[model samples]
Target: MNQTTNTVHQDVEYWLKNIVVGLGLCPFASLPLKENTIRITAFLGTDTEELLGFLEQELTTIEKSDTSQIETTLVAVPNCLHDFYEYNLYFDSIDRLIKINQWEGVFQVASFHPDYQFSGTEPSDRENLTNRSPYPMFHLLREDSLEAALKHFPNPEDIPERNIQCMEKLPEKQVNELFYYLFNKR
Candidate 1:
């Protein structure tokens, strides 16, 4: 293979390995489907071009995203304002941008997490959710598959404190499954 091909291969593999090892889950794990399938879409976002630039640069290292293997898509947004994306077009634009960069991932962008412009909601409470001013929630999978291990892995607290609060409600085996799903195959 040529130097360019090797570089792209290494880049894509780097993404896969980081997601699998660093996050304790394969990047592919985020793409789980119902009934032991992979979700095509996963969520990720950043507050500034700094973070987005990092992800984009890393992803660009890959030759292609290979979305054809996925049943759905993996949507990543930059500048996650108001805890989510505001317009479908904006997110869709993100998806397009990913494809344009030569990554072979698949995903459809949605407009959830509205402006959070409601009345009567506590300022502190709302602020808690939006403390960072902008948040990014990943919505992976074509249908609904919360059963997947890629439950709630946002950009923060990923350092593995070993006391994940959500682990309580779930069973031991289920938690293991999640860990394996997210942690294995790095």
Candidate 2:
């Protein structure tokens, strides 16, 4: 079992490494392109102007004389929400602003950082667990109503019926798996 786990871990490590290097680029250079690359952009939702500026700047940053192009994008997420809500919001925000003309490859980028709350600089970049305070990232995935908005919606009598319903917590492994589900490519 441990060996199998090791093999899986190594595979994941390899995949992640590939993502870092491959997706390290963006595709909209309009110049020549390169090899074995998957360009990407990561942006915060609250900053639209800056994100566009950064995207324009990267066009020069990743350009080469070769004819191959890197998949470029203007990724952005909401500043306040940790992951999902911000992710969704930013997607919506840019969905309107994205210029479809003069584009190459995929025009991708969104607010959701997979499991943003748990994915960060720590312990080999592992996902956050359910034992943890519900990550703010979850705010974007879907609101649990009373379970989530209790502090803001303090009118005890005004709670919604959908929120009043209880949800079972996932087991530890399940929680971890959920993080993987959200982050991992399908």
Candidate 3:
């Protein structure tokens, strides 16, 4: 990988470890992460077409692989979709792409960004931190894996509430440290 790609990949890995798994935000994340089954790729393309194509390739890659070898993928796009609203608007195309490819039910996309925000909350709300990441990345998850994980997990519906509470309890210093990329963009 080039230096930029390497840096972004490392940053994403750090965020996944310290913020996501360490905070207990996603109970299912730790296993794949520890097993080295999570794929993190930095997509440096700035064009929408290129990104969509790249995503299609990634989707195909994960879809064709066994769950034990490739559990999930995080495609980090640091060169495009900087605005939260614009990034969100692009999801329509993403959904359409998934449907067209007939992978809608097979896999799902989860979004994480530096400026991630929930619909009913303010941008400054601590709850938004739960979905925040160092860069704008699309998490391609397997529906079957998610279903299995949820079945084994207690009160899967409560995960969101628990994550929000976890975010709310964090100190400002800790937030700034864990989410330093929020303040310093590439």
Predicted model with the maximum lDDT: 3
Model 2, range 1-186, lDDT digits (tens) per residue? Answer: 122333433433332343222232111112212333334333333455775465545544444312234333222222434545454565554444334423233233323244443333343233222212211121111112223434554464532222212112335464344345344533
Cα lDDT of candidate 2 equals 0.33
RMSD of 3: 1.8
Off by over 4 Å in 2: 1-15, 18-34, 40-46, 56-81, 100-112, 116-186
Instruction: Give me candidate 3's TM-score against the actual structure.
Output: 0.96
**Which regions of candidate 1 are displaced past 4 Å?**
1-32, 39-45, 50-70, 73-80, 83-99, 102-107, 114-186
Over 1-186, each residue of candidate 3 has an lDDT whose tens digit, in order, gives: 123888889899998999889999999999999999999998997898899999999999998899888999999998889899999999999999999999878989999988999999999999999988888889999999999999999899999999999998989999888888888654
Better of 2 and 3 by lDDT: 3
Expressed as tens digits, the lDDT of each residue in 1-186 for candidate 1 is 122333333433333334233344333343432232322222233344443454454343222333334343333232344332254334554565567765434322323232322334443332222111111323333322222324554543452233223333446575444334223422
The deviation in Å at residue 157 for candidate 1 is 40
Given candidate 1, what's the lDDT at residue 169? Answer: 44
lDDT for 135 (candidate 2) = 19
What number of clashing residue pairs does each candidate have, in the order they appear? 26, 20, 0
lDDT per prediction? 0.35, 0.33, 0.91
